[model samples]
Target: MSDGDEPAVTGEEVRNVADLARVDLNDEEVETFAEQFEAVLADFETLDEVPEIESEPDLVNVMRADEVEAGLTQEEALSNASETEDGYFKGPRVS
Candidate 1:
């Protein structure tokens, strides 16, 4: 809301929001919260006065290209396993 204008929000509106959020607010608290909401909205009006930047955003490829690589052999892969069965790592059994 602009300066000198009535608040866009009212006590009834604030109470509705509080109810939706499951918040408990007395009548005085609702009025206070309504005023705070109006002030916050008024503060946001200042952002409209900010100048917009006129430039294309610079974008870059941050990731390296994928390359083919050699992987570990079966024996190397299984060398450190605490337990193995056939050609696979064996994990603890679950019920």
Candidate 2:
């Protein structure tokens, strides 16, 4: 339950969990997984020692100010199109 303590998971518990998850486990696998689970949980307990810090990040306006700009005319825009209908790019029917 805590760091530096033996993992409390048992083979029976592992077997029960495996059964619930529809996983087939033999006695050997159950024993192996019980030990593995304990080691994993013990590793997780070490995370408790990580120092907590402010969650907020530095706030800054990194974006450039918005400005109106000249855009391509309809003729220039449609010039590259493989197909155009009524001054608009024509795509294939979807339905």
Candidate 1 local lDDT, 1-95, one digit each (tens): 64456667889999999999999999899999998998887788778778898988888889999999999999999999999999899999998
Error in Å for residue 12 of model 1: 1.0
Name the best candidate (by lDDT): 1
The whole-model lDDT of each prediction reads: 0.89, 0.88
**lDDT tens per residue, model 2, 1-95:** 53546457988899899999999999899989988898788788878778998888879899999999999999999999999999999999999
Candidate 2: segments with Cα more than 4 A from true spot: 1-7, 53-57, 73-75, 85-95
Which pairs in model 2 have colliding backbones?
A: none
* Candidate 1 wrongly placed segments (more than 4 Å): 1-5, 85-95
Candidate 2 matches the true fold with a TM-score of 0.65
TM-score of 1: 0.70
Candidate 1, residue 45: how far the Cα is off, in Å? 1.8
